[model samples]
Target: MTRATVQRWAAFSDDPGGGNPAGVVLGADDLDETGMQRIAADVGYAETAFVMGSGRERGIRYFSPVAEVPFCGHATVASAIALAGELGDGPFAFDTPVGRVDIETRTDAGVRTAAFTSVEPWIEELPDATLGALLALIGLGPGDLDPRHPPRLAFAGNRHPLLVLADLGAFDSLTFDPGEARTLMDAEGWPATIIVLHEHGAGRWEARNIFPVGVIAEDPATGAAAAATGGYLRAIGAVTPPARVLIEQGRHVGRPGLLTVDIPESGGITVSGTAVPIG
Candidate 1:
C-alpha cells in the first residue's frame, strides 16, 4: 500500500502552538476507511481530515483515532489552509458526510485564514436524565448552570450538548473522568464533544469542549462546537440578528485559540480562523 502523505496543521490560530492540531491528508483517494483510521490513530490528533479529488471542490472525510466522525470544524479549517497552500488561496467546497461546506481562504500579510459556512443549524432540549448524568460526569450540578442560557443540544454538523456555566470559577475549574465520559458519550451517540461555556461579557464567551474519546481531555479550539453555539444563541434568542460572537478556548489546556463566529439573520453560521503548519 502506498503511504499517504500527512500534513500537520494547527487550526484557529496563526501561531502553531496556540491552536488545535489536526492532520490533513490531501490526495487520499488511494486510502480506504481502514487506512484513514490507521493514519488518524497514528497522527494522534483529536481529528484528521482526508481529502480526495482536487481543485476547489473535493470529497472530504473526518476520522478520530477510534472511528469516523460525521463532520469536524478544526480539521476542515486545517484542510482548507492546506489546499490553499498548494492551489492558491480562494474559495473551496467540501462534500462532507453531513453536507456541502463552502469555505473561503484569504491571505493577508503572509498569513492565510479560512472561513467556513456550516450546514443548517438547529437546537433541541437535553433530556433531564441525560443532563443529570452528564453533569455528574463533568462534576457540575444543576445549580452551576447559567439561567441566561438554558441547556440544549445544539447541532451544526454534529450534535453537541451545550451547558452554560453561571460562575466563571466553576467553568475554569472543571474536571471530569475521561473514561466515564467516553462511555456516556458513546452510548448517547455523541461522538463529538460536550460544550461547556461561560458568557464572560456581552458577545464574548469562554468555552471548554470535553472530548473524551480522543487522546486529549479538552480541545483547544472546536469549530463544530463554536458553530453549534451560534445556533444555540439563535434558537434561544440570546442575540440579535447579524450578531458577531467571539469564543475564547483552550486556555485551560494552555493552547489558547480564538474562534470568530458570525450569526446572520437566518441560515448557516460562519466560523473564521487561521491555521499554521506544525512541526
Candidate 2:
C-alpha cells in the first residue's frame, strides 16, 4: 500500500483548542478495513476520515479508534475543510456506508464552514428496558435524563442513541463505562451512544460521553450526534419543525467548537462546522 498523507484538523472552531480533533487521509484509494481501523486507532482522535477516491464520486469512510464506524460527523467536517483548502470552494460528495453525503463549504467572504446533509436522518424510540439498562450502566438515573426529550435512536450519516440532559451541570457530573456501553450498543448494532448536553441560555451546549473502558476524554464536538439530536427534538416536538439551531461543544475540554444543526420538516438533518488545520 502506498503511504497516505494524513492531516489533522480541529473541527467546529477556527482555533485548534476550540473543537473536536480528527484525522483526514487525503489519499486513501487502496486502503482496506483493517488498514483504516489501524490508522484511526493510531491517530487516537475520536474519529478519522479516509478518502478512497476523487471527484464527486469519491468513496469515503470513517473509523473510530476502537472500531470502524458507519459515519462520523467531526471527521467529515475536518476532511471537508482540508479538501476545500487544497481544491478551493466547491461541492464534494462522500459515498459513505450509510449513504452519499453532499458537502460544500462557505468561503465567499472568509474561511469556509463545511456543511453536510445527513443521509436521510430519522428517529426511533428506544425501548424502556434498553433505556433503563443504558442509564444504569452509565451510572445515570432516570432523573438524570431530560424528561422533555425522550431517549431515541437518531441517524444522520450513522446512528446514535440520543440521551438528553437538561443542563450542563448534569452533564458535568456524569460517567459511563465505554466497554459496557459498547457491548450493549454493539449487540444492538449501534456504534455508540451520545449524551446531548442542553443549555438554553445561548442555544449552545457542551457534550461529554464515555465509551466502555478505552478513551477517557470527552468528544469536543460531534456533528453526527448533533444531527440526530436535532431530529429527535423534532420527533418529540421539543423543537418546532424546520428549526435550525447552533450548538457549541468542547468548552469543558478547552477545545470548544461550534455545530449548526438544521432540522427540516421533510428530510434529513444538516450538520455544519468550521475546520482548521492543527499547527
Candidate 3:
C-alpha cells in the first residue's frame, strides 16, 4: 500500500503542544479498515481521522490504536481545520458511521477554528450496577458524586458516562487503574468517562476525560465528550436552552485545551475549538 500523508493538529488549542493531538489523513478512500487501523497505531494519537470523497459528500472515519470508533470530536475538528488549510475556509459535510456531521471553519488573522454540529444527542439513566462498577474502577464512592448533576449516559455520536464532581480538588486528583477502566468501558460499551466540575461562574466547567478503551489513559481535550456533556446538561434541565458553555480540559494533565459548546433549544449540539498544526 502507498503511504498516506498524515497531518497532525492539536485540537481545542491554538498551541501545538496543548490540547489533544489528532492525525488527519486526507484522500484515504483507497485505504481499507486494516490499513487505517495500522496507520492510527503508528500515529499513536488517541484517534486519527480518515477523510474520503469530497465536497458535501465526504466520508470520514475515526480509528484509535486499538479499534475504530463511530465518531471522534477532536479528530473531526482537526480534520476540518486541516482541510480548511488546504481548501480554504468554508463549510464541510461529513458522512460518518453515526450520521451526518456538518463542520464550519473560519480563519481570523492567523487563527483557524472549526465548529461541528453533532448528530441529535440523547441521554439515558445509568444503571445502578454499572455506576457502582465504574465508581469502583475509579476509586470513587457515590458520595463523591456531585448532587447538582446526576450521573447519566449521554450520547452524541458515541456514548460517554457523565460524572460530575463537587470540588476542583476531586477533579484534579483523578486516578484509575487502566486495566479496570478498560474492562468496565468495554463491558459498558463506553468510549470514555466524562468527569466535570462546575465552575464559579455560569456556563463554565472543568473537565477530564478518561479513555482507557482507546488505549489512552486520559485525553487532554475530548470533543465528543464535550458535546455529550452539553446534551446531558440540557436533558437534565441543568442549563437553559440557547446557552454557550466553556469547557476547560487538560489542565491536570498539563495540555490545557479550551472547548466551546453551543446548545440550542433543540437538535444537535455544536462544539467549537481551534486547531493548530503540530510540527
Better of 1 and 3 by lDDT: 1
- Report residue 57 deviation for candidate 2 (angstroms): 3.2
Model 2 per-residue lDDT tens digits across residues 13-64? 8887678888999779888889988888888888889987766557888888
lDDT of 1 by residue, 65-140 (tens): 9899999999999999999989999999999999999999999998889999999999999999999998998788
Off by over 4 Å in 3: 192-198, 213-215
Q: What is the lDDT of residue 195 in candidate 2?
A: 57
RMSD of each: 0.9, 2.1, 1.4
Cand. 2 Cα-lDDT: 0.77
Cα lDDT listed for each candidate: 0.93, 0.77, 0.88
lDDT (Cα, tens digit) per residue for candidate 3, span 177-268: 88877878888777545555555467789888887644578889999999999899899998889999999999877899999999999999
Number of clashing residue pairs, candidate 2: 11
Q: Candidate 3's error at 25, in angstroms?
A: 0.4
Model 2: CA > 4 A from native: 211-217
Off by over 4 Å in 1: none
Using lDDT, give the best candidate's number.
1
In angstroms, give how far residue 245 of model 2 lies from its true place.
1.1
Which model is ahead, 1 or 2, in terms of lDDT?
A: 1
